[model samples]
Target: MVLPGVYAPQEDTELLAGALSDEPLPPGAAVLDVGTGTGALALEAARRGGRVTAVDVSWRAVCAARLNATRAGLPLRVRRGNLFDPVRGESFDLILTNPPYVPAPDGTRPRGPARSWDAGHDGRLVLDRICREGPELLRPGGVLLVVQSALSDPDRTLGLLRTAGLKAAVIRRRRIDFGPVLRGREHWLRHRGLLSATDDKEELVVVRAELPV
Candidate 1:
């Protein structure tokens, strides 16, 4: 369940969850869920027997996650802070994220509900940061699973992870109809040449990156 201001579990969440369900994680593996909204992904990892830690910058999200974990009887370490900050110096065997990838005009990060989806122009603000910093928080042989819209450039994500020495590839993809945010920005996307005038759907991609042992 999602609280006000917390990101609700939607299509992207289901896609990431499906990918997570297919993965084979070691017993008692350490898992971190960055930008975990309502603890959905973290709970999924925990359900698979991973010792889960969830982080979010929004207090409401943190509370919602904690409550969900309690109701579900899962042991989740929920932290309220920016991505990875609350778990500095910690390494996880697996990391999962469904970060904001919606392209917006302003580079200024939003503090309201928009923070859940309004990524900067090109939608690489959070994506780039995750690609750059996530490797440091992974153990050798650790895996990072991230979901993003194709409009945000999955190729760049793969390239960035590969540059960071991880073998990355798109493990899963699903085409979904445009939501309110995309609908609102459809004209802008068309004007920017990122989307065709007739495009009403976007492909969501799940990227799996594995650090070498």
Candidate 2:
């Protein structure tokens, strides 16, 4: 169960989960789920026989994920810290992240539930960091899977990953109606030219970047 203030699994989370199902995890593969809100994706990896560790910047999320993993009878190492911080000096066979990619007016990270989806105006605040740091944590032949909204420019993510020497591409995409946070800022987004007046549905994309085998 998701604790209050922890990000509950949503469409993006499910989309990532489905993609994870296609990944053939070798037995005992080390997996890391950055921004593991409820341990949803982490557990999925564990189910596939990967030894998983989940990292979140929110303490509440870490506690929630830890609790959920215990109840699920899966052993998940959940840690509270900023992206990649808790797992520094360690690498993994796979990294999964559904980071904040909703564009908000302020660039500053929120201190409340808003932190779940409120990314800076361009929504690249967290996405950019993940792209840059993700590869460094990958073992050779490792893969980094990240989901982002179309509004935040998935192409940029692809470019960044490729620039880092990974063979990267959009593995999956889905169109969904705007969530509450996006609905509330529709006008602002349109005004800022990030969205068109007629645009009601946003596209979510999963990018897979693989280090050369």
- lDDT of the structure predicted as candidate 2: 0.92
Candidate 1 similarity to native, TM-score: 0.98
Tens-digit per-residue lDDT, 61-107, candidate 1 = 99999999999999999999888889999999999999999999777
Candidate lDDT scores, in order, read 0.93, 0.92
Alpha-carbon lDDT of model 1: 0.93
lDDT, residue 113, model 2:
88
Instruction: Report how far residue 209 has shifted in candidate 2, in Å.
Output: 0.4
RMSD of each: 0.8, 0.8
| Model 1 misplacement above 4 A | none
Model 1 per-residue lDDT at 102 = 92
